[model samples]
Target chain A: MPSSEEVFEKVQAALMDALGVDDDEVTPEATMVGDLGAESIDFLDIVFKLEKAFGINIPREELFPDDILTNSSYVKDGTVTADGISELKARLPWADLSKFEKNPRVQNFGNLLTVNDLCRYVESKL
Target chain B: MRWFWIDRFEEFVVGKQATALKNVTYSEEPIDDYLPGRPHYPHSLIIEGMAQTGGILIAQMQDFHPKVVLAKIGKAEFNSIVVPGDQLRMTAKLMSLQSDGAIIEGHVTVNHQPLAEMELAFGILDDSFGDTSFFLPGGFFRILRSLRLFEVARHEDGSPIQIPDYMLEAVRQEAAQ
Candidate 1:
């Protein structure tokens, strides 16, 4: 049971190791895809480094999850409905989405993921 | 006996994972027989390509001293079809490694589109299994050399892998010929 600070350090290190980015680019608010420039391919590399660094098994599905936006149960129109927002909130509790909650789009859900979110997820797993 | 599935490896990290790429071409013999009119790469062969990508990684993890065999395919699901002219990028990651064997999880994609996913298990045949020629055929080494696999491969800590003696011998012998 490592402290949150410890987890944050490991997470930052994993990101740096996987993406080869500078130390300054890995702030907690940095989004993996946006700020860190993580493509879909980098996700596997990131997960692998995290698993090795923390000695914890991180399933790919648990991290990004399936694109539930395509399923009718969550999305009725192009925009995410109340049910969809609830599902997103439940799935991504670590994300700070007060801004996203105002108007959520199915496609933009990926944008909500953040570096802090990853650290929080790791903490929860521990 | 002959390795044909894996064309080359793009990335290989010893004891960690590997990413290999195979090009599905109509010039291949199997394509002539598979689906007469609408030619498509066999899903089975695609899976085999993934197996080779992972199998080689698993074997190399232990320096290829033990015989590695595909014991089982725990799961494989094809999401889309692969046709000629498409390049398949297959990545295999070590799930678990133990004394007896190893488990690997693999995924294949074409131009970033998901093609298939698989979970494979491999058995490492130890010396007690009887007189086993763990050394691969000379031709296999030739293919590996052509692909420059050794040049790109690295240990988990990013250090260069010391090419095994038998492999070096085979390469040396093949080069002399």
Candidate 2:
């Protein structure tokens, strides 16, 4: 298993390659979409590069659990309830969602994800 | 006629992953049927090609005992245009496999440039549940042989897996024809 520092370095490299961002832009606090300018489609490239770098199979569901998103108990009328946010937090403990916690939206959670979140997730997998 | 979106698999592991190739030609029916004057592979067919690649890999992993069918294309995205003379290389990696179904992650590239990415789900067809035969035609094995699937395949521990009996039978049937 890699140290957390090593995982952070690798994760930064992956973000640079996937999003074509500069070194300064891929900070721990930088959000994937809002801060780093990652489009919805860039997540696939990020996942692919992360898998190659870590030599681990990260299931698509692991990135965003489909069952939670689709479950009626979590989502109601396209909005995520408090229960949904709690479940997402439990699953994605790596994310620093202090801002999202204030007012979370179902469609915008991807945007709320941060570079540090991915680094922590990959470290856990390793 | 036996219809296959992908021509043949070039590289494969029993259950883990696979790589296949498809050639886009002007003579093919879909290219012409999709648009009379403008000939380009449609996104839908491209997705089907990915699904077929992943579906067959899952089926082969189960040793072909249960018929595998494309249950859902959970996600698909095309990034570039594919036209005649383009050779698409599709790679499928198994994500999760259950007794009843599987989920696969796949990607396609042309000349090492990204073409598409896909998430495909497959269900095992059970005849006891009023299932019909969805097996690829016997000729599929002939194409598999030509592409060296059996020669290239291996398990995680680097040991070769025995060719399934049904595949052997398919080859025999193709030879008889």
Cα lDDT tens digits for candidate 2, B85-176 = 99999999997665556768888998789988887767666676575555564655666666667777788888876777777887687789
Residues A14-123 of candidate 2 have per-residue lDDT tens digits of 88876779989989988888999876445656776688799987777777666887789998887778899889889878777677777666676777778888888888
The TM-score of candidate 2's chain A against the true chain A comes to 0.88
TM-score for all predictions? 0.55, 0.55
Tens digits of per-residue lDDT, candidate 1, B4-34, equal 6878889999988899989888888777688
Best DockQ among the predictions, by candidate number: 2
Error of 2 at B98 (Å): 1.3
**Residue B145 error, candidate 2, Å:** 2.4
| Model 2 CA lDDT for position B40 | 85
TM-score computed on alpha carbons, candidate 1: 0.55
What is candidate 1's lDDT per residue for A46-101, written digit by digit as tens?
A: 67667878888876557764566777887777777888777767887777778677
Q: Count residue pairs with overlapping backbones in model 1.
A: 0
Give the best candidate by lDDT. Answer: 1
